[model samples]
Target: MANHKSAMKRNRQNVVRRERNRSNRSRLKTLYRRIDEAIVANSPEQARQALQNAVPMIAKAVNQGVLHRNTAARKISRLTRRVNAFAQNS
Candidate 1:
């Protein structure tokens, strides 16, 4: 219940941003799952491709303020490491 006009406008903006962020997060999760599945299935090429696709999206999420820069970096680092390890092992 935003009584003030400005508050109401801000609330509306918040709702839009919340939904946008939610979708972005869901997409990221899907990408992560794809990578994880590829890893578990021992498909190096598929895992690498999924990691490649996810990195830029993660960065974009950081740029869009949906994720912190450090958080994005950490995620990218972990995914890359896992993919690299799987590649080396296979």
Candidate 2:
């Protein structure tokens, strides 16, 4: 219901941004799940590799404004901790 031209343009932009953010978030969740699965499988090497891949993806998400820097840092921290713990155990 955006009547003004500028408002219509803004609405269009919002739709695009929403989709982009959703895709990024979905990708992040997938990456998190992969790391979790690797950890549960008790493969430290695989978990480590997944974490290595995830960290940069997470940073990119933060850079793209899909995720906050603190949130990204927190996720990276927890994932790294889990991977490190797995390494210590195995």
Candidate 3:
């Protein structure tokens, strides 16, 4: 148990921070999923749009210390390549 008022306050702050981080991570993951789905569906237009929107979101998460920059770059790279191929084919 938190023995003092300051410790109790710290506990509350930690809880709030954890929830916020979870939400932010969840949002990033959801966008990533959407982009992947569009790519697999071979919809060039949708994939491009999703990549346009997701790029900054992924970068922002990395900037916020939620994701590593290399990880974000790898995801962006693969998604872009997939969408570009779709565009070329269609």
Steric clash pairs (candidate 3):
none
- lDDT score for residue 86 of model 1: 91
Residue range 1-90, candidate 1, lDDT tens digits? 999999999999999999999999999999999999999998999999999999999999999999999999999999999899999999
- After superposition, which runs of candidate 3 have C-alpha atoms over 4 Å from their true positions? none
Positional deviation of 48 in candidate 1, in angstroms?
A: 0.4
Q: Between candidates 1 and 3, name the one with more favorable lDDT.
A: 1
Tens digits of lDDT, candidate 3, 1-90: 898999999999989989988999999889989888987887888989998999999889898878898998998898788778888998
Give Cα-based local distance difference scores for all models: 0.97, 0.95, 0.88
Ten-residue segment with the worst summed lDDT in candidate 1? 77-86
lDDT of 2 by residue, 1-90 (tens): 999999999999999999999999999999999999998898999999999999999999999999999999999998899899889989
Candidate 2 residue runs with Cα over 4 Å from true position: none
The RMSD (Cα, Å) of candidate 3 is 1.7
* Candidate number with greatest lDDT: 1
lDDT of 1: 0.97
TM-score of each predicted structure versus truth: 0.97, 0.97, 0.82
Better of 2 and 3 by lDDT: 2
